[model samples]
Target: MRVTADLDLCQGHQMCQVEAPAVFGTDPDTDQVVVLDEHPDPALRPQVDAAVKYCPAMALAVTD
Candidate 1:
């Protein structure tokens, strides 16, 4: 699946980073979510989905 992060909506909560570090990260300079991998391995879908679901700002999304 493919992951997407809306920086404008991101609050830098770092939940995504915690759930899926390989797919998401934090931008120290901007304190926003960074899409480390727009497209991640399918095996990582559960973690990615958790990140998206837990994002307080609802800035994360996933698509197949």
Candidate 2:
């Protein structure tokens, strides 16, 4: 699976990072959501999905 983020829509909430630290992160300066692993292992799909779902800004997406 692949993870993508819309930085413009990100609100620095960091929920994505909290949900899936292995696949998502936040920029220290901007505090925006960052995709740590654009292409994460299938084993991490559940985490990735949770991250996307919990993102308040709705900036995260998954493509499989």
What does candidate 2's lDDT look like per residue over 1-64, in tens digits? 7789999899999988878899888789998877878999999888889998998988888987
Residue runs of model 2 more than 4 Å from their true location after superposition = none
**Local distance difference test, candidate 1:** 0.92
lDDT score for residue 15 of model 2: 85
What is the per-residue lDDT of model 1 for residues 1-64, given as tens digits with 9 covering 90 to 100?
A: 8799898899889999999999998889999998989889899999999999999999989998
TM-score of 2: 0.94
Error of 1 at 57 (Å): 0.5
What is the clash tally of candidate 1? 0
- For model 2, state the Cα shift of residue 4 in Å: 0.2
Q: Each prediction's TM-score against the native?
A: 0.96, 0.94
After TM-score superposition, the amount by which residue 17's alpha carbon in candidate 2 deviates from its true location, in angstroms, is 0.9
